[model samples]
Target: MLKTVSGTGLDNLWDDAKASGMTESDKLLYRSNLLGSDKRVTNYGGGNTSAKVMETDPLTGAEVEVLWVKGSGGDIGTIDKSGFATLYMEKLEALKGLYRGPEHEDEMVGYLPHCTYDLNPRAASIDTPLHAYVPKKHVDHVHPDAIIAIAASTNSKELTQKIFGDEIGWLPWKKPGYELGLWLEDFCRKNPEAKGVVLESHGLFTWADDAKECYELTLDTINRAIAWFEEQTEGVAPFGGAAHPTLPEAERRRVAAALMPAIRGMISEDSHKVGHFDDQDAVLDFVGATDMPRLAALGTSCPDHFLRTKIRPLVVDFDPANPDIDGTLDRLRGMIEDYRADYAAYYERCKHDDSPAMRDPNAVVYLVPGVGMITFAKDKATARISGEFYVNAINVMRGSDAVSEYQGLPEQEAFDIEYWLLEEAKLQRMPKPKSLAGRIAIVTGGAGGIGMATAERYLSEGACAVLADIDAEALGKAKEALVQRYGRDMVRSVEMNVTSEEAVAAAYADMAVEFGGVDIVVSNAGIASSAKVEDTTLELWNKNMSILSTGYFLVAREAFRVLKAQGIGGSMVFVASKNGLAASPGASAYCTAKASEIHLARCLALEGAPEGIRVNVVNPDAVLRGSKIWTGEWLDQRAATYGTDKEGLEEMYRDRSLLKRSVLPEDIAEACYFFAADTSAKSTGNILNVDAGNVQAFTR
Candidate 1:
């Protein structure tokens, strides 16, 4: 059943605005927020809303009816009045008279900018004319999952008629433009009593004189359709009662450990774009279902999905516990190639002049019971959104199948829409980005301090930052905090002890499942130790080595393994110290462990070079500002070594350096980003010193 939003907070929006003369748009924005906030009504960036406002301009003293519709490049849920582009409705309606149809969407779009009332106008959504053509004061269009379930089914026309009867109209598939708007205008003029219309293989549209009424109509109509469908298949069992078991959380992590890397290695090779992965219970259940092979063969239920999930998702037929990780990956590679071949064939079948060349064939990959679901894309948000759409699509089809057979748009219809000019324009609305826009990054010990700083840097450049740390509590807080800046789907936090191979492996696998794979590994997890070489106990040496040396080995080696599998060259940055290059008395354990990791990194660099992976080291010294590494006991030791307090030691180290400057964590992060990005494309097996001009630590 569709749940309607409460009017409890509606007064709050009008409270302060009433004294300031609130316009009709203030109410429309409130209604749009009601629809936008619910995923059941509209997935991310997949819906549009509008209000036809007749307002008198203060300057011109002229009353004009204008359409304020959702603009390009904004999500309706969090949108405000500014997100709605104001267009002259009469001028927009006149566009219907000039329509020749079909391929003229390009020319139709040109008039939109001219119709805007603002000196600097935002681009209205492609569906602008449809809202203007409707004879109602308010219009709401949403790709509700249930609506799509009914609309995308083979019996869409019949089901649509059954649910709404004479009150709803049905419009055949026509790309959104002046022609479609004119056709809709004629249909609504004929069916004046209809509350809404079902767009064949697209979405739903409801209209009314009131914004609230339009929203309520959409919910009520869609819910009734859902109810009728559910009623038809009363007492039905999902998947014929077959079991689609999921692995235990621990086991799933272990599988992701090996699988994410191999998949990453297989698909990418020295590319600027990064791959990300996502898995959930629904995704796992869908992929692990007994009839997934057949169920997944049906194409996307809606066209917007094509922009993210591609035509069809790939299914992996291996177990997570497969003894031969390499062999299983090799077989998976063959399956991927086969999927590509099939995709190419499908594209050729629908080939036309405007047809886009085949996209990367690995948009969505279904894993077996042990591995769960894996969704991939060029960026983190896209990967997760694509996964959400696939999961929703799978469930929608399942529901549609329970009573009636499931069906999507015909091959030709989907292709025409996918390659169509208006739809393609919607995707290009976002501004350009850096090369790191699609890259996946991981910062060990990332819950706070340097790790968090590094993670923030990656996110600023549009990379997905996975904060891997041993502290589960801190990790959760970090994820929550980062979400406010980069969005909820852009940041991920995984708890893993970097020294434990099982944990490290599972972390990567989970990363693979959550994001497609890893491209940049910042080996920054470590602890400090200070003792006279003769007085250094076995415990002291072990603790330092476990975190500083062994941790680096596991994090880097596992990352390399995945990179090798991806066949995409990547970057490995070990955060060593200046103490590793120059002897620091009484810091035997910390110095030796750091040295070992630096040497190990060079070895990795030498080995990883052949596959396009570049391994490097960033040796930063005297970085006490906001660093957990130099706190408490470590701080005491450094101060003791200098025969002074913490502040005095920092000052001594700063002055010892040629530049007389204190190094910060961000300074080191900058160096790490440089190596990971394409800026240092030709460099490898090198150590860059970021120690405020430490001559001894400088690389020749």
Candidate 2:
């Protein structure tokens, strides 16, 4: 059975039945997972866990003590066995002799490889010494919000004494390194009765000889803090009471949709960015707080928080009583420029002699009063995670401010961690970003084969996609599959009828708020009709033109609006048909509509050239595999026109091609990818024929 003190406390999740059969190492992993499951215990990737276990030496076949800790850049919440770095306990103990005191503590990380036990390829983290030097066999270092709240308070040391007395100790702030590990070891030596220690402005460190005890101790420590805060601050107003009123849910979303695209445009001059909007209760309370600007300027107290969210967030001047989105838009660029200037100044003041050059100075987190928070990054996950870290910071601020004066880390200390040599080296080791890493694309008729395939290709190349379709059921399925494959942050689905002007505009707004802005637009929604000129009714002709011609225009117009708002050049891939270039018998209405799409691309290409927005067309013929269009009456109509049955239509089209190869949905998808990517940056207003070498459809 799980144990809990009250409604507000964390439930003790350890199951002895589950841990009974596991090895000591596996038990350590199980404990880490349980502790990481709640943000109240630790935020994502913000903590490390370790255990000392006996292992067989590969060479001597003799048992030896080994230290197993979470590797560099590993998240305890999702980490597996392979994510742990194995180091010899004796070798780690030997590192103390080479350590030349605090000034040169960074050099200790260089010697960690020498401590590798069993030749484990996983790199050890800087926190390894902190965990290894602890006297106990099991240890955890986590940035739990409840504990950090006390750690970040101005009276943190006294607060710690009041809360837990001698049971839990406190230490002055020290950058995590070999020296900090020694500091922990020394503190333990002096206070043999202490359960753990809170590192000022950093996080909590707890240990026990047994993995289960350590895990339980961590939970108990955090729960005690939670209960104390709840009891003491029962009637206190959070963030000194809200100074601004929160807008209705729909209004908040509307404001976010409007502001995101403009802000995305100004900041994306360096590289395209994805955006995440958060309107959680904590964020709303903080953003509306009277002290928000002051607290935000002071920045986050924890290094892990600021590392992802930047030193501080930019507060947007948005008021719910007088929501002036247009006025805000006019001032957005200047606001961003001022932020960049402030960041540059911060760098100049705090940079060390060997500091890396200034990075993208634009703020990662944006705070809007009466609205919510918005975050942008090179990818969707980073953007969302950055928002999460900011939320954690907000939680810390709420608790500390209510009970005691909250304090952010000193500016110089924050900069030192932000531009640390070790951190810089770790960043340099990351793989280069993908070609479409930050690009956002909107695919019309996204549930269809061609649209789905194109979205997949872009997603695989690191682009976030918004799939728009009239088919709600099919759209949901497509979104689900894509989300499963690419992660939830990278895919969104909006029910949109491209033929409706309002629907198209709403879809673009949804995309803008979901991502930062649009960089690529695939106008692939279409219809097929087969009738001789004499037999074709006006209704059929209008239907084809409404979906194929006007729908392209609506989607493109909205894309251009957002693309221009962002001030970034974008790609427009219009999926026309081979019939547009080479007319087919018995399909006058479809041919005319597709032909209109071809000409529309040329016209838009001319208008968009000055803006660096490339417009092109991909003309695909007989894409039968997985094509919804081919599965309908058009298949029978085309087969009858060729004097064959449905099964023979694909063969007839394939054999008719000069290359005699069937054009799959994937084939058209490749063409769309080319036009959307930088590989064709130099070419625009051109048509590519993907019909297995169709001579008739060939472009001159």
Candidate 3:
């Protein structure tokens, strides 16, 4: 049977979250408790809560500040201050102006680059803007069990109307982020006095002038709906009291970790914020009993909760002595494949656009005979919530049907919600391309390490790339490597200097003709000139900028023209250096050129917003393999200049960053691919620090 907490306990959490004396962490925990009070309330990292703090502007002497939102992948229950991503209200509002409608989202996001690099690379929640849109000091978004149950029902609209009345506005489920924010903005503006908004097939959103009010409102609203549900089905009894065997704790954790990534991808977030739950008694009882398959088929309480607890649970027969673990695993894999096939078929039937499909299942519940229940989430909070909801839903469903049976939103409806304009807006805002198939891309300095690695990365991801370098022999070698891997038809070789516009233009035109048109460009060519500011000369300055800055401009201009003419948006990646932000004693020109490239990316992002072209820069530090920059001789020389051994120099660099390690070419390539792929479609104008952790000069 589903468990219910006292109304007073839920109310207390609201008061606690609103109290001023509590630390930020305490407030977050308090908010989480309030959000998690009901079984249908929240699952793992499926929900978020925020409190806005007003601070005095040091410059203006007026109270103006930022909204400290839950960082990307943060679970509402356990998130602390460190889990919150701060955004200047003004800047967030400014982002709103970038897109006028759904069509322009790709262009707008392409122009507004990621502002800083100090925070985690995991993106801020798509609902960041929505929380900001709420005029209240506190805001929350959750995949409440009751709410999802209500939404998924065929009579959802009618039931919601009967329960919440006209005060609750409804928006069709849309992808999160800018698109959802825009929709919510419009909804709020139109409704003017709505208490909350419920997204069909999605979840719930509530806000209040204070944290307490928001929490209380959420509780009251959900409870009222529950009351109505009880009235409608008064005779229904809780089901499934049969027990199942349990698994070892260590084994369970291992399986759970392996399962999280798939779940996280399903929910469109990282698994780091997921909560975990493992109760051997519950698992054993649930899985060991008869009709385990029937119990596992009920859908999640909410769509967001899918990541923590997959659409269905897994029932395993436990036998420690004659353990058929391998056989069991194989069966599980087969089941997963069946689930995916079904999901794909549903998507095909419901999809409106050509958006790529998601292959990961959101959550998985484990049922071991004689064991309690074991639930996995990216974090502890998520896991706990999943367990709570699972226990409740199983009880409810089993009672209703003798065997638990639940229905999901129609495949078409689910697909529509999953691919809603608002959600797509968030996705579109990513600073990458939607598809690189049949697109032409050029990699400057392509004969060298980072450049060659990036070129290969692009090829692997399905783009026809041309490798250009000043050295014909090296270009040929690089071309051979790529051709050997992807075939000659996919790669081209050219000898050119990035600094020369004629060379850049000719290469771009030739490649465009060969591949039909240019769509992606990576400005990865440049030389490092190390000299102190006092020892730097105009010649040194000009030499560095000529290749790094001017080369990028030439390539960008050519790409812009092609993309504009094609009337399709494209992406440009400029490879900058960690020195662009941090200071090093004897590298004036290198630093200056890299910094210039960063600014150039910003300017290009803004300029290309209207043309459906996006420009961004990747600042990488200590990239080792396939780069001339991290060569042993090069490191030795740099180490000598710093009056230290090569090992010492490496250590110094590594120790400077939070994640103390050398950045790999593949790492930069991954970041580059992120910008170049459809995943970052809405993002433009952002600068990604592919460095392991070095530059810590600014905070935003």
Candidate 4:
């Protein structure tokens, strides 16, 4: 229940760090603060931190640089420059290819050279590969108690959806190291604009050009997550009742010593242990009375802590005669087996490959009936942090009834992540796609109108365009135009009736095979009808609804399906007329259909937001120059109805807006580009007006 620390002193710290110069002491202090922040967020040794330094190379006797990351076995808060394991970036990327091969997991086991000093004695963090993957100057990864408390709950995905929208990407839990690095590498390539990433059941990561920005973003991200959780649950409540009466200091020491070895084995670290407990009398009484199994199950919030603490711990009831040592050990081992079996089943259902799983569980908490709780870590600092995360999660769950029931990615998906060939290929092959390159974009009704304009804009922005239209010939001509500008390989023409579900599904299946997946969809296939309310036939109304309302849903649904399958962030844009906001004479069918599209955008925006798929609507006024709806006959009929000459009628429509001008198709195209780019990363369900300042009678 502890909120994030304030940012009041952060700017001052940045300035001080910048002005003080990089003295040995200053560097050590900065590293300490970085590590401390990470541990506070995640469990003991459950997170990683790194700093980049520019030092001359000893081998070549030239000015070569290297990244010095946190070495294995060192606590973040206590580590010095000597504690870092340095690696050349070129060498690290080279390792990706060797590590990705199926046999490399088992074959590549020898220690790789890190830095010049203590090369044989120290090892790098397991997350080194990921740190290498990012091009940022600095990186920090942590499993904040507040975030994990939320991520561990069954409602995590839904709650995250409601909170961060489609901007934040969520990946199912996977063991850290090479495989996890590859998964993240692929994600970063796909979402080049993302601020950070949340690893479900794992932790969070934030990186930037500088250390200060990275740190502040981390705090802000976690605080936003906490705020979202609070908003959903109304408020957070305190955890279980008070602690049990205290025990002798010697007895506590003895218990901690017994647990230390197991923790050391998990983390492969040799360190000291420390213990603390709630002083509340109520908490003491409750812990003393609660069931041993329930209390122990609440151990560490994430799995990486396993290296610092074992899977489960011993619970002693303070028996004198029958100390129950053998029984307690047997029970603890049994629970570990149960946890492993459950974990294995989850992996089987979620993993896509046959990679070996981690040998240890993240952490364990021992409940000593009346002697209070005993927590263990590879280091005292880690143990303390782990205890805090567990206690906070326990409280939140008890208060929210938000028990941890993970919904892992399906087996194939997990396999894809654990043994991602695509990510490995990216490191070795051609340069990564320009931020938006190779991304498939579908624009409905993309033939000689607003749709064509948006398609052209997407091409200029580097996305491969797939233009769809009911008119096969027009779609073909539009494809030729796009190909002339962006080359034939970057554009495709598809004839589709968006109103037909079968047609939409078939097109998407073909498009998925052709483009790998669809990343951006502009649902702009709409028809306008001009008829008086009394003269509007039922058939005409249904036809308008079919193409405008039903057509939009079909395209969006299919787009979401494809994006979710690809496990990538996607964007969708719905085109609604200004008349949808205000009634117009002789256009009931068109107005109602457009209004439906607007409402549909809001609903889909909320539903798709969690999956990193953004949905937005653009309301455009009359722009009929290139449209069939603005034919000479149509204009003459409208002019007669309005009792004005054709020129006067056009002037009236243009003058109705505050800008006193007509909105071009290019104007709407620009709005679509904004919604499609990184600039609108946090926007969804927003109604952007492309109208020349026309006031609506009623606003949503």
Best by TM-score: 2
Candidate order by decreasing TM-score: 2, 1, 3, 4
Better of 2 and 3 by TM-score: 2
List TM-score per model, in order.
0.90, 0.98, 0.45, 0.43
Per-residue C-alpha lDDT of model 4 across residues 1-700, encoded as one tens digit per residue = 2223421222223455462667432453474455454333554445667655565566676654466677765656556666677776666666765664533553332324633322434566566776767666677777665566556566776655666666566776665666777777788888878766777756777777666666667767776766555555454222333334444544543433333332222222222222333323323443554333454454433554432333334454453223444455435545445655755564466544544543333334545554445564322334455555545444333423433343322334444443344333333455543445545688998995898999988888667788889998878888898888887656777889998888898677555433435678999997777788898899999999999999998999888776665445678999888887888888889899999999999999999988888999898887766665566555775777678886787687788788899888899999999898878989999888877887773364
Q: Per-residue lDDT tens digits of candidate 1, residues 155-237?
A: 87887887789898888777666677777788899999988888876788899997666767777876676667567766776
In candidate 3, position 628 carries an lDDT of: 66
Could you list the CA RMSD of all candidates, in the order they appear?
3.9, 1.8, 20.2, 25.5
Number of the candidate with higher lDDT, 2 or 3:
2
lDDT for 645 (candidate 3): 83
Q: For residues 204-320, write the lDDT of model 2, one tens digit per residue.
A: 999999999999999899889999999888988888888999999889999999999888888888788899999988889899998898889989999999999999999998888
Model 1: how far residue 362 lies from native, Å: 4.2
Taking the tens digit of each residue's C-alpha lDDT, what string does model 3 give over 473-519? 88888899899998766788888887777887767555543343556
Q: Residue 98 of candidate 2: its Cα lDDT?
A: 87
Where is the poorest 10-residue window by lDDT in model 4? 263-272
lDDT of 1: 0.76
Stretches > 4 Å off in candidate 2: 1-7
